[model samples]
Target chain A: MTARFAVGDRVRVDDRTPPGHIRTPWYIRGKSGVVADMVGAFADPEDSARGGDGLPERPLYRVRFRQTVAWPDYAGDGRDTVDIEIFEHWLEPESG
Target chain B: MSTNVDDHDHDHARTFVPDEEDSLGQYAIVEMAVRELLIEKGVFSADEFRQGLEVFDKAGPHLGARAVARAWTDPAYKESLLSDGSAAVKEFGVDMNLTELYVVENTPRVHNVIVCTLCSCYPKPLLGAPPDWYKSRNYRSRMVREPRAVLAEFGTTLPDGVEVRVHDSTATMRYMVLPMRPEGTADLTREQLEALVNRDAMIGVTVVPAP
Candidate 1:
């Protein structure tokens, strides 16, 4: 399947927690970030976790977030940043 | 019963059992049972399972060290490595298959560190299984929260000017750090350079010290 978001699109991770194994971390959930890179498509790990055939691969993107935004008590300078790989289903385009 | 004191002493000796925790004992029992079931069902033979394990056993950090050393010496190769790590490692006879490898570089301004926040997703083809600490819950949770503190525990103290970029391996992609080549190693041979590259350095816990 083709990727919906490009390298520079702004997106926010969906905050809702699903009942199964998810690749997105809790800290990055509901946080907004810019897409760093497209990591190609692969089997949805959520489905694979349940022993179900992981078909209909989803595009994964490396989302970059400022360290300060991720952690309120972040000790580092503003230059620090974190990159997390999030599946397309977990991300939504940020509204203006 | 008191008539046979010698026989009673031996019986007590037999009854005394040491309380030791064999961490792998339980897993081994389960693994053997599962293997037997699979074999009985004609899934895969024991020989095939052993062969697969042997492949993982043969892989080590040296393979990744070779790739890092090559990148240090060759600029064009470094570019290729930074762009496509899985493809560039093939030059050194390391096959990563379809596993996506993204090589993050550690520069003067940017210091890159990696962690599998969800689970232990590592570049096992090049570096083998992760060290015990890498898979610990402390490292997984703390690394993303306080990378500098974690690095310091590994005896790595970076300058305040550098930006600590932590890459969370949260998806199918696995990451390896292309650590900055230590200064004063210009005269060293390729093999010597490779020797200096350790697993921790690639994981971004510490830098390769100059030898």
Candidate 2:
């Protein structure tokens, strides 16, 4: 239930694809972003969807990524960004 | 030959019923079944469910507009709204219940737009059900990728220096945009300001101009 990543910490979304309903978007997987805010914790939908208790809520964060990182062909201002809510388990400390 | 007056069988081609698509989808049917089962099981009474529906039925963009007007006229209130969205909205009688409300401000340098790339996770307590376009697959996929182009489609062309911030409501938190007040409205009353704030403006698809 504790948040490993704090605000301003750099993190990258894990690029794993599992079966059943997922809260993480496919586009954001493997992409890097900065933790913008700690979103507390909630039952991980990945488990909750399967009729599990979803106990020990997973910490979530609002990760902000440059729009360019999401779409390299993006034609808008380089500073444009996209903020998405991601669960802690889906994020890993940025390697580089 | 028409047994019923409304049928109008006199026409040569009846057109196979105008809408074969009226039937509820699989998930919708499942939801209904689950709801009935819960009510029957005493998880909640039917009247309680009806009360919940009434709350949702009473929602619309005007509730959000009222909050926007208050924020526009009062700097202190604006700070509260920007800091804790759900708490500030509660003052105006918007209770999001378990769902958290995240308010993003649109400033001169930054323009904010909201979308649920996964599904339609809007701030329904403040703005009611999302528009059809908001729930469309095209919007869910493209808004985060080409927000500028999407804004252009909605006739919202931001300045070159402005940063377009796209918020993907992928998780539990619902989002609503607090658009920058248009110019020349300095003399307008609070009610007038609320009248000027529309659904699209709060959705961040379009910016309202002063009349």
Error of 1 at A6 (Å): 1.6
**TM-scores, each model vs. reference:** 0.88, 0.87
Task: Enumerate residue pairs that collide in model 2.
Answer: none
With a 3 Å backbone cut-off (N, CA, C), the pairs that clash in candidate 1 are: none
lDDT at B187, model 1: 95
Question: What is the DockQ of the complex in model 1?
Answer: 0.79
Predicted candidate 1 versus true structure: per-residue lDDT over B1-211, tens digit per residue? 2356578776676577655455658788798799999988989998899987887897889988998999999999999999988898877666776577799999999999999988898999889889999999999999998998898899999997999999999887779999999999999998999999999999999998988
lDDT of 2 by residue, B35-153 (tens): 99999999999999999999999899999999899999999989988888899999878899878988889999989999998879999998999999999999988888889889999
Once fitted onto the true fold, the runs of candidate 2 whose alpha carbons sit more than 4 angstroms away are B1-41
For each candidate, report what fraction of the true interface contacts it reproduces.
0.93, 0.96
Candidate 2 vs. true structure, TM-score: 0.87
